[model samples]
Target: MEKIILASSSPRRKEILNRFNLNPLIVEAKIEEKKSYNESPEQVAMALAFEKALWVCNKFNNEEVVIGADTIVVLGNRILGKPKDEEDAFRILSLLNNKEHSVITGISIIRANTNIKIIDYESTLVRFRHLSEEQIKRYINTKEPMDKAGAYGIQGYGEVLVEKIDGCYSNVVGLPLGRLDYLLNKFFNIKIL
Candidate 1:
């Protein structure tokens, strides 16, 4: 197998790739993730993903295939990012309580030597079960929601908070495995299988 590089420090993303037997070289991209209000959610996600991949791509040989991903939580037009503190986490969780929101992940794959690049996004609908203020506070105390978008991790203790999901489950976990496999096979002639 060719060397694969992951332009992210997200453990969830690394685990997702490892689950498919693709153990990518972990190289965190040193780029600022700035969301633009001028662009749509999908566009912002894809652009950030591409920038991350591109930043990492410049540091490696062209033979290396690099993957970059960014996940964002959207409630209506609002993009909920990682919480700044415990209070912010509470606010985010409160906003998501008993509501269905969109989880969008942007993915970018690039082979710098060939100048080949593919940028795409995946969207999943996640509905949170109704929760009391105490439940939200206890979950916040767990600190799992501090570093995650939407103030929840569907794969963690936060699992109990979700009523259901309408799309790719892995997307909510930070990567979309199906979309990733498709992109790799179609654009890079690489197969996760």
Candidate 2:
């Protein structure tokens, strides 16, 4: 099996990969998450992920399979990024209250030694419940949403604020394990289980 390398600093992504008992080398891809003018959210997500993976691969041996991912919360065409402060978190949560939004995640894999590269995106529809002001304030106090997109972490206290989800839950959490498993086997012929 080729060495697996994850190009991200997200502990959530690492935890997701750990579920398969795969201990990949974690490499931080320090790239600016800037979007092209009028770029669709999915496109931006995929591009960011590709940039991260490619950045790491340029330094490591081709025998290492470098994987990178980026996740974003989109409402209509507007992108909701990590909050700058608790007040910003409250504002983001307020905007998402009682509405449906999309969580898009881009995944990229590169193995120059094997001449393999993949870039793709997955989206999940998440609906936030009608949250009272008190509820939002309380959730923010937990400090989970400060670093998460859309001012919420579906895997944390934010779950109570979610009314429903229309797609892969893992995507909202940061990584889509099912699609990743498929890609791993299809591209690298590696199995997680």
Best by lDDT: 1
**Tens digit of lDDT per residue, candidate 2, span 87-121?**
99999999999999999999999995567899889
Candidate 1 per-residue lDDT, tens place, 94-191, comes to 99999999999999999968779999999999999999999999999899998898989999999999999999999999999899999999988999
Name model 1 segments beyond 4 Å from true: none
User: In candidate 2, where is summed lDDT lowest over 10 consecutive residues?
Assistant: 111-120
Query: What's each prediction's TM-score?
Result: 0.98, 0.96
Following a full C-alpha superposition, what root-mean-square deviation does model 2 have from the true structure? 1.1
TM-score of 2: 0.96
> Candidate 1: lDDT of 78?
95
